[model samples]
Structures are given as C-alpha cells and as structure tokens.
Target: MPAPVSTASALPARALLACSRAYCAAAPRSSDICSSLEEQWAKIVLVIKYLGSKRTLVPLLTKLVEASGASTGLDLFTGTTRVAQAMKTLGMHVTSLDSASYSKVFGDTWIALDGETANHSELVDAISHLNSLTPAAGYFTQSFCIDSRYFQPFNGERVDVVREKIASDYSGTWLEAPLLASLILAADRVDSTTGVQMAYLKNWSHRSKHKLELNDPVLLAGQGLAVQGDAL
Candidate 1:
C-alpha cells in the first residue's frame, strides 16, 4: 500500500475562513463567529454518544498527525472522521476518503469546505423543510420496525425524517456536511438495537429509548475497505 496524504495544518486557515464565510452567508451577520459550521448541532452530539467514540483517542491521533508533519490528511475509511474532523478543527487540512458512497457523501458534506460564505437562517429553514418527509421513503429505514418491541414507531419515524432530509439535501459545504454527519450520529444513538447488530433488537428495544437527534451515519462510518477488482 502507498503512504497516506495528510491535510492537518495547511487547510486550517482556509477552512476557518470558509467557515466564517458560511456563517455570514447563512445569518448575514457583520461580526464573525468562530464556532462550528454545522447546521444540525444536535446531530454532532448524538453521533459522539452512539459511537461511544473515543475522544481520548484524539490525542493519540493528533500526535500521529503532528509527528507526520503533513499538510493534508486523508481518512480512507473516515468513519465519523471524528479524529480527522478534530484535527481539522485544530487547524489541519483534512480530506476524508471512504469507499462507501454514503460515507463519502457524509464526509464530503461535513468536512469539505466550499470556500464561501453561507446563510444560516436559510440553511436551518432548508433543514426543517427537508426533515418533513415520509419514513419509508427515507434512507434510514433499512432495519426499523415499530411494533417489534425494538423501535418506537414515532421515534423511528422522527429519525427517518431527519435522515431523509440529509440524504435528500446534504450539499457539499461547511454547514450541511457536519450537520448531516451529526444527524447520522443522532439516529444511531436512538436506534433500539444491539451495537453488534446494526438492526433493531426487540428484547432490549424498550430497555432504552431515544429521540431522533443529530448523528453521523453509522453504516458508512464503520464500513471496511474492499479493493475494487480484487477477488475474495
């Protein structure tokens, strides 16, 4: 295998500038804010919980990145791209690459910067509008069931709605990508299933209940790589 590409510090200034632009475009504010650019703030929190993600690992990853001294970093699998995103936040030029289409979509939307300003209110409104869709037609409905004791129908429905919005309208930008990634995490958190099985589990379904919030896409985030044209 070849060596990986690193985008840690080179892109930070540019990414930060893009984030500010997105903020301004979204809200039309004169003052600049240096917070996250994700539209679905709740989603980011939700993903952290669902993945039982290792924030502790951040230091380790950071150390590795720092040691490498690369201008850009590539996360081939890019699950949550948690470490990568963190590195980006800390002023790295990070590029998350994934084999899975969904994972790629999420990463592209969340981490890739448009290098432009954004409209916050309009983005929020857009999310709301996209969020109001039927459950079965959405992307997260692969293993959901209401009466099987696994997923509460209503709660599952809400998750489906949020997912639908993301799949439908997660454009490439600072705000949309992270927000959608967060929503992917949120849905995984509330899923009434065992971590081992990505599907719902009837027995433990009610043991805990979760409301649809923001999250990263579990399937995409956890996927392993398979080289194309390689035989099993």
Candidate 2:
C-alpha cells in the first residue's frame, strides 16, 4: 500500500503566503509583509487590520467548504474576503458581498472582480514602475501625515505620488480597482493606526516607520461576483 500523505500545512501556522516576499498572516498586527501577497494553493495570506478578519480561520474554513460538496457558495458577510478567497480556491463559484469600497477591490483581486486582465509578468513590471515614481507631498501627505498620524511623512508622500499616477492612468478602468487594492495593501504595512483605522497612535508604532511599497497582489483564477452594498 502507498504511504499515507500528510495533510498538514507545509508552512507553520505563522508562515503564510507572503508578498512576492509580502504580509505575514501570523505576524503581529503592527508589522507589514515586506513583499507582495502571493500564494501557492494552501499558502494564502491577506494582511488587513480588521477586528473581525477571518484569516486565521481559513484552514478550518477550507475543510468545512470541502465537506459541503457544493459547487457554489455565498459569503454574505465577507469582511476581508479571506474565506471567500479560500472557497474560490476550492473551485467553488464564490460570491463575496461587503459594503466597503475597499472590499470591492479585494473581491476583484481575490474573487471574480470585473476588470481588464494583464499578463502576470507585465503586471509585475507595472508594479515596479509604480514603485519607481518619485513621491511628492499631496493632499494624502497633508491629510494622513500632517493632519493625521496614519503614516509618516516619508511613506505618505510615496503613497500620494503612486496613487495619483494610478488614478491618472487607470482610473475608471478595470485595472483601477485592483491597482488601488494593491496600494491599500502596501500602505497597510506602514500605517501607524492600531489596525482598525478608527484613529492613529499617540506615537508612531514600530512598523509605521517602514517605507511604503507596492507589490503584486496574488491574483486568483476563479468565477465569482464582488458585490459592494448592504448585505441586506
């Protein structure tokens, strides 16, 4: 008889799909993933500071979805779209619904978001270009850096320039949503807020000092609809 295969996760509970190098699902709430969100099968990582993110529950959730034997599933309250992303990996037609605009980007990037598709390598190059642009002080810098303490002045300027470039070039196109999503993920790494974004810290957190960078968002191939609105 053939030897039994181990069903355990290859990476430890803390080792999750990282960005080209990217965020650790197991890392502290204060740090950012250095690379981009990239995953291979069971190795999925999404680092968002939400009190209700189900990222850690994905392993168990995947098992449940597998047992259901259903081809389609509905994630009515997709908070961070983590479960929905996992369900899609199971080859199920998944629908992720949330009321937040950023959720739409997550839905498009991980789920079946509407948008123009590009070659993966080309997308990488585009991300590189975004990173190369010179950062400038814009409304984002003044508001988030000076007015508020979400990010330091250095990283805030980086955020501003890159976002302005993306807005100018890809705004209103399918590319726009995912690109914005990518920026959000990158910025999340260096922000000073205490995860929920309700407010900033009295002092800059340890991770808030890192430079802002954009990385490739792990793109999943599956069928699903990203809905933005009231779940009701």
TM-scores of all models?
Answer: 0.53, 0.75
Q: In model 1, which runs have C-alpha deviations exceeding 4 angstroms?
A: 1-54, 114-116, 130-143, 146-150, 161-182, 204-208, 214-232
lDDT of 2 by residue, 1-232 (tens): 0111222422342254323333454554534333223323222211223565566678998998899899998897786688888888888899999998888888877788522354677667778899999989999999999998889999999999998998898787666766788898788777776434446878675567778888887777766888988988
Best by lDDT: 2
Q: To one decimal, what is the Cα RMSD in angstroms of model 1 from the true structure?
A: 16.5
- Residue 228 error, candidate 1, Å: 12
lDDT of 2 at 14: 26
Candidate 2 off by > 4 Å = 1-49, 113-118, 195-197
Q: Model 1, range 41-92, lDDT digits (tens) per residue? A: 3222122223334456778888888888876666656655566565565556
Cα error, candidate 1, residue 61 (Å): 1.9
Worst 10 residues of 1 by lDDT: 223-232
